[model samples]
Target: MTVSIWQADGTQPVREVDFLVVGAGIAGCASALFASQAGRDVVVTDARDIALGASGRNAGFMITGLADYYHKGIEQFGHAAARELWALSIKTHDYWRAWAREAGGVHMDQRGSMLLAESLEEAKELELAARALNADGIEAIYHAADPLKRGYFAAVEQPWDGSVQPVELAQAVLRLSGAEFIANNEAYKVEQISAELVAVHTRKVIFHARYVMLCTNAYSFTLHPYFRGMVIPQRAQVMVTEPLPDSVIPVCGYSDYGYMYYRMTHDNRLLIGGGRHKFFEQEADTTDDRVTDGVQGYLDGYMRRFFPEVNARVDRRWAGTMGFSADGVPLVGTLPDSPRIGFAVGFTGHGLAFAAGTAERAVDHLLYGTHPGALWAGRLTR
Candidate 1:
């Protein structure tokens, strides 16, 4: 699509682009990069700076597999579908590794991850997951013995999965994407100009493109009501503690079905997040990114319980909004009403794990008219 602006002196300035991506988070940045690499004229815009949202505020674990446990995923979607989703996550992890290498190896650390089992029942579940994963040729080990000093009964270790510095990764993606970026440009409205064009209006400028991809995630509902109930927003609180003398957490870890996750940073600071379940009612359907006392208290309690040896104080605390679908899966496809506009949101809190592959699939649908076989395709409209 082509956009023309009439200057005060009656001169016309025109800009044409093939794809316009909204939101500068991981999904949006990845979309822009893929489109540009495919020789498409792409433009990316964000209301805030890159990685200021959930993309930056997450626990930094580059995990493989679904947000839901593998056993639960098999129960919900069956084995074939669950396997596909797991495969997709592994592909995303490989993509990040390749991208990081190409971008001078920034923000990526290949330290494997473990899912802690707080109870015997949870350990059985982990054992079931490990079996299913190994059956599918994915390596997984169930550690019946406690590997860490924490009081977890058992753990499921995925040696292939790792962690990344989320903010640094986002910055590297934006810098290496080679797409025109307009930061601090908040898109207020999106209009389908025609079957072949979409228009995005920000406070300062109106962007026109042949195709528009919305990667807004949590803020999607604000831009369009179509995603209101389908893609609900939830606030996730995170806190980083003062650097300790020794590393307490050897590997990235999560427990309680990923409701709580923590990892020791390279600088020996414990960066922990999660606990929305404690304040589910207040956190659900809200875009507020402020850390609430209730959730913060829960996180603090978790830290004290898990790392009692470290007499560290919370150095920083913040919150970020994450979109969640009825199912844990993300929404990825074109909007039913507007085929020219595509979206990839509702990743729950697994954006970092799913963003790259999700963006690539969405772009494939947009560019080549291919059908996306996303596990949640049934939940999302065309």
Candidate 2:
């Protein structure tokens, strides 16, 4: 599986490996971990340092469901399909828990999570969702009473869901992966040279591998046209307030149907993220990672409205790009025309919940010819 790649100086530098994984995020790191564990020669390269992308800049929620609520998923994807999605979501959560435990268990907290409904209508929606979840043998209890005393009409608590320090988790996973990591090296292009070899061009050098896995997520579109329109890039803003006196947020939680999420860190900082719905048009199809005034303002207003008693100022703010498929499901397995190249992208805004799982599955498909079934990368129509 040796391939020759012409260097910028017109000389060919050939290096052969079993797997060359793009992006050092969670998915990339997980792929490297799985492949290396299976006795494969793996090298993972990233444009920036590990976990610098969305992998680090997320709300740190490790929930056990899709991006949408159970009821909403049923309405949009039908009952049977939605049930399967839920089952997979639970499996992803379990996988994450086990991995975190194996990585020393310091980066995760099993404090559980809740979905708060701010209005009576939203409360009904939570109730319906809880019913649907319980019917599928998952534990979901709906509470009409607001325990946080924030004037929420209702809430649903999933005892199994928890939170993880995303950055720490990613770093730990990278260390445990046992794969050669090349940081600050961005993969610019991937060319299939033969049936079993591919050339990956980066700024520093060209990597030749038997199998090339694309774990770049939102940035996948920049490397190839196959993902240009299929994987739409979206920018999400997030902020962390100064340390509060007590745990303002007792547990990880989401409101407004998982759009706005907040969690209390181990140091008692209120980490909140999500305003994409407020700036839907502005946030869509953009690779810009700059945090805008509009989205930040909305987040601040939301904090004030929800937690008026605590007036903690925002200490830090940033943005991260996420890839959203047309139907919001992640894409996994091999690409359309390039059989030697595989991809795991388009996780929407729920990368933490699905990235590692899908990356492992992609590696399985690439190495053993196993199909990803419903999550097949080529199944995305738009």
- Which number leads on lDDT? 2
Q: In model 1, what are the clashing residue pairs, if there are any? A: none
Report the C-alpha lDDT of model 1 over 121-217, residue by residue, as the tens digit: 8888888888878777778888996788589988989877778888878777766788888887677778888878887776556667899899999
Q: Per-model C-alpha lDDT, please?
A: 0.81, 0.82
TM-scores for all candidates: the values are 0.93, 0.94
Q: Which pairs clash (backbone N, Cα, C closer than 3 Å) in model 2?
A: none
Off by over 4 Å in 1: 1-15, 375-378
Distance from true location, Cα of 99 in model 2, Å: 2.5
Write the residue-wise lDDT of candidate 2 on 1-382 in tens digits: 1122442432435678888998888888888888888788888889888988888887788887678889898898788878766767777777677777888744677787889997788899999999988888779888988867787888999888788888888877887888888887777768998888898878677788999999888888788878877788899998999999998877888888888888888778888889889889999888889999999998898889887877887899999988898788888867666788988888888877787778778888888888776577666653
